[model samples]
Target: MKTLPALGDDARVRLSRQGGFAAIHALSRPREIEFAQCDISQRTRICSVLEGCLTLDSTVSGRGDQRFYQIEVNYRSGGQEDRMVLKVPEDQAPGELVHLWDTGQLL
Candidate 1:
């Protein structure tokens, strides 16, 4: 599984060759993890949120005779930048992840 960090307010979207996709969002604090499975034909979409700016990890695998691909997102405070890592099949292209930080002041 590959891991990456979500930077900024932009949402990160990943697509799989088997018609699967995953979206992730990063928060300033640690939060509860939520997951839901679907019965779509050959396609699945999963989402996860991190409450406290921290590492975000995710795993994607094909159901019924499939390999597993992993992803991780690392969020760091004090630094002005975010970090991300990607691990996927050699036959597949790289995925994109976004990172964003809170301004601390609310509107």
Candidate 2:
């Protein structure tokens, strides 16, 4: 399975030309990642969020009594680059996790 980002008033869409080469033959850059599994039964669902050039990749996985939701985000701005990885238990709400990330706190 695949997940999608929420689109609201802050969302805008743009298109970029990435096919072919300017002069000689060149390969087009890939814009999306392809998952190895196509069938829903063999796939795990996740959500993606794009804020400016920043991307938030989130997913949930576990076994037995342990389960967790993980989020990975990385971006560059103002000549500085940053990355964050967060994992929240399945029993917990994602709001608090977002708050922690917003505050630059890690757990």
Candidate 3:
């Protein structure tokens, strides 16, 4: 379980996994994004500019195998629902999942 700094105000937070699976929770809302073995060759990425609250669910899986080799994130916010799916290769390292909430800002 990895915890990222809160995203500005409004009780928002971000989290990610390195080589396994990870989940994120805000209050009671839950959302997710993941990177799997098959994702090795595929590039999985996310970018968000929030006007309100944004929630997402993403999954990455290995090819040929029905079971995803890895599960990365699950997150939820205080708003409507949004979802995304990405396919990646099995050689990519999981470290790629780490990303700054607001890239333009300095920590």
Candidate 4:
């Protein structure tokens, strides 16, 4: 995996899940952009949690009966594009990050 740059407020995080159903929730800091599943207020919180590559230290495995999560982070800085993406099984993902797929809540 590539190292993530020091992210700025413009950073964006998308949480996607799959198992019996599919869903996506995005936290985007750029105020003007509009996306249905986006909850702007959570942008700062999620971004802070994502710093230092949280939850990316090791590879995660999944089972068919449980939900799996894909976390994608994106941002542009200094004329370059930088991003980090990871997939984690429900059993291994952080509780707060997984909550969004089920209850649309974050801690």
Measured by lDDT, the strongest candidate is 4
Per-model clash counts, in order, read 26, 0, 23, 0
- Local lDDT at 81 for model 2: 49
Report the lDDT tens digits of candidate 2 across residue range 1-107: 22333322222222111212242222211122123322332122212222311222234433444444344433343445444444444455355333333442213
Report the lDDT tens digits of candidate 1 across residue range 54-94. Answer: 13322343444432233333345356544453334322422
| Clash pairs detected, candidate 4 | none
Each prediction's RMSD over C-alphas, in Å, is 15.4, 17.7, 13.6, 6.6
Clashing pairs in 2: none
lDDT-wise, the better of 1 and 2 is 2
For model 3, give the RMSD to the true fold.
13.6
User: TM-score for every candidate vs. truth?
Assistant: 0.20, 0.28, 0.23, 0.55
Superior by lDDT: candidate 3 or candidate 4: 4
Q: Write the per-residue lDDT of candidate 3 for residues 2-75, one digit (tens) a residue.
A: 22222212222233222223322232122332323213232112323221112222244433332221222233
Candidate rank order under TM-score: 4, 2, 3, 1
User: Which scores better on TM-score, 1 or 3?
Assistant: 3
Over 4 Å off, model 1: 1-66, 72-79, 84-107
Q: Looking at model 4, which ten-residue stretch has the lowest summed lDDT?
A: 27-36
- Model 4: lDDT to the true structure: 0.54
Global fold similarity of model 4 (TM-score):
0.55
The runs of at least 3 residues in candidate 3 whose Cα sits more than 4 Å from the true structure, single-residue gaps closed, are 1-61, 65-79, 98-107
Give stretches of model 2 more than 4 Å off: 1-64, 95-107
